[model samples]
Target: MISRAEKSANYLILVVFAVFAITPILTVLQAAFGPSDAGGGGGFGNFADAWRIGHFGTYLRMSLAVSVSVVVVSVLLSILSGFAFGVMRFRGSGPLFYLFLLGIMMPSEAIVVPLYFDLRSLGLTDTFWAVALPQVAQSVAFGTFWMRAYFRSSSRALVEAARLDGASTRRLLWQILVPLARPAIVTMTVLVFMWTWNEFLIPLVMVTDENLRTAPLGLAFFQGQYTQGFTLLAAGAVIVATPVVVLYLFLQRHFIAGMLEGAVRE
Candidate 1:
């Protein structure tokens, strides 16, 4: 049914967009491997030098810790709360759901100053919890909204059949519907992981200790203090971005399937 001309046009558009998307990354890679501004080594040697000087090993581990903690806590809480709001009807539920939405609506910039003071008063600043807790809160807000939508759009006949088979609410949610919602869950997980991994501001405002600094924040300090050249800086950027890229690639199929399923469902 499709004409060859239209198909060719679509391919042309995709090729153009792909090139546009890939050019910057290719440029970064070239710079990352090019000569150092200090007039010395190049190639993968720059990455080695940058890694040694930047302390990326420490920063990356801290980032991994923060991102993992945020993702796990956010996903768990979001599932529980989303199930409650989506599948169960209760008093004041409407108002409570809106309260959760406030998290998505609110910008971190609006509250970071006061949030810092609150965490400091609680003696949580300059610690791992300080960097992670805020991000967890932010992720949970969006996660709940995302999970709630998936659960609400779920198959009612399947849920009814599960209930009739004597499945408890928890079992129905965890065992039945949750498995069917894999794509949606994976999509949300990828999003939360990416956001938490790339988050810079909360960590910056919450912690001052060098050990507590995450990769992005560390990259900033790495740029300012240790590096005076473009090569090392580019290499550091590549190092910081690698984890997120690897993660997306690992989950690419499920992530894209989920996004497409959601689009078709809506």
Candidate 2:
């Protein structure tokens, strides 16, 4: 239990951080709904103009397509790989596992130039696949590491019992491992969704077609033109931020529990 002073400090910290974090969002909100004329009163006209000019409905669809697909694929693959590496023992496991650990340490910016050429060779450049593939790869490294840690500390007796019941490898994972590992899975899903949704640099470099641009890319363009469009930009920011906020709200407990499990295991 927190003391009164500690609670007060916590609120103070929350307030300060909220202001700091919300300053840009507020600016965008103002631009989105702010005054239309040079020095006129605030109104909803800017949001209307931005909506029409940005083709935001289409961009929202593109963002949903890319982000949802990336999250699903990334979560499924990470669970499979993390469980294999965490629970199963085989030849060359140590070395291969460390290779993945190395990938977690590597920064996306480091190989982005090569990634560009690699995508170009595959003829996926400027497509949703180009962005999705790299983002998935980037997420897998850390997701594997984190999920692996969670699986490592999970109940061994349950795994053994499942094996005794004649469960196959795939069934054990899907039926037993995943159910027990729900907290970690939810945490990884939230984190990956946030990253893939807000990602800008990769999409900025990979996608040239305006129609295929994700929300972040569209916001960048909107900001460039509507330099003073605070209210409209705020509305856009709200739109872009809504999904992740809702995800965190739903998964907050799972996220915290997963983090605690990893910390204890490590």
Candidate 3:
């Protein structure tokens, strides 16, 4: 139960946050559709022009390719590595796990110079794999750590039952752990998708060719080349942002549940 004053305060806080969140978005939306001479000769017209001129359709396709590939590779690698660390005991496993954890603390920028040089040496610079492989490597650390925690926290009783039934490692993971960890898997998938979709710096450095540019880099190019057409840039921004926002809205429940229930008590 709440008092009238408390309810008023709560509503006031909600209003404040709403303004904070919506103001820029509304401004962009308006700019996206405003009439010409709304400060520039370009308006929603600019959006259509940019989309066609910039070949944003192709860029959108390429970005989706990179994002989906990153998510799939990252999730698969995380699951395997996490199961190894969580369920399989081996020599030096603790140290190896800590080494993976170190990735979480380090910024990707710290190794960009070396990474770029390495990719160049491998003839991978300007390739889709250049952007994707690094993202996979970087994301793997946290993804494995997260999934390992989820697996460890899940029912040991079930694991024991499976073992008594003579379940092999593959059987346990495929038949038991994977199904039970669906919530955590979905959360990690969304997180990886969001990260890879929005990733900019690595792609910017590695992919010098225009055809290989990710959406964020494309947005940067749009902003730079079409400075007067703010509406087009705004529209582009909205296009890039919409998919992840929709995904989050859909999977937010599983994401929350996974985080809450993920870590094992040791």
Candidate 4:
């Protein structure tokens, strides 16, 4: 239905955008692996120095713990809540669903202050839970909305057949729906991992302990201490970002398919 000229124009635009998006990353990579001093050749020394100086080993461990915990808790809660909202009928379901939708509409900046105070009141400040819990809440909100849409749009005939087979409600979800929802689940997991991994503001505000710092927060402090060392800084940035990049690379196909499917349904 499209002309060759239009297709060419679209391709040109996409290529331009891709270059725009990739230029900064390429620049970072160059600086990360480029010459460190006046005569030294490029190598991994900068990364080693950065890692040691920044105490990124501890920061990385903290990040992994929080991110993995948030993803597991958020995904499980999202699945249960999403399934209920999508397929089950109950009193006040519409209102409750709308309440969860409000979470997606709310920005973190708007609630982070109150959230910090509340956590502090509970003596959860300066703890890993301080950083992880709020993010889990936020991720679960979006995940529920995402999975609910997926379930709601699933084939009614398939659900009916499951029911006809005398499958219990739990079995219908886990044995039948869960397998079919693998793409959506994978997509949500990737998204939650990326968000939780990259979070900064919550950790910065809630945790005062140096050991509890996450990668992004640690990178900020590292930058402050090594403001003049561009090579080390670049390497640190790459180290912080590599996990999410690798994750996306591995899940690109499933993520793209899930996104496209969601779009088509919408």
Clashes of each: 0, 15, 0, 0
For candidate 4, write residues 123-232 as lDDT tens digits: 99999888988898888888889899889989989999999999999999999998999878988888788878998888999988999999999999888887776888
With a 3 Å backbone cut-off (N, CA, C), the pairs that clash in candidate 4 are none
lDDT tens digits, residue span 1-266, model 2: 78999999999999999999989767765665656643434466555555676678778888889888988998888898898888899899788878877776676687778888988998989988988988888777777888788788888888899899999999999988898887677777777777788888888988889999998899888778776535666666767777777877888775566546432211
List runs of model 2 lying over 4 Å from the truth: 1-24, 34-45, 254-266
TM-score of candidate 1 to 2 decimals: 0.88
The 0-to-1 C-alpha lDDT of every candidate, in the order given, reads 0.85, 0.78, 0.82, 0.86
RMSD of 4: 3.2
Q: Count backbone overlaps in model 3.
A: 0
Worst 10 residues of 2 by lDDT: 257-266
Name the top lDDT candidate: 4
Worst 10 residues of 4 by lDDT: 257-266
TM-score of each: 0.88, 0.83, 0.91, 0.89
> Which of the two, 1 or 4, has more lDDT?
4
List of clashing residue pairs for candidate 1 = none
Model 4: residue 58 alpha-carbon error in angstroms? 1.4
lDDT of 3 by residue, 163-248 (tens): 99999989999989999998788888877787788888988899889999888889888788876656677777877777877887
- Residue 218 lDDT, candidate 3, scale 0-100: 91
Global local distance difference test of model 2: 0.78
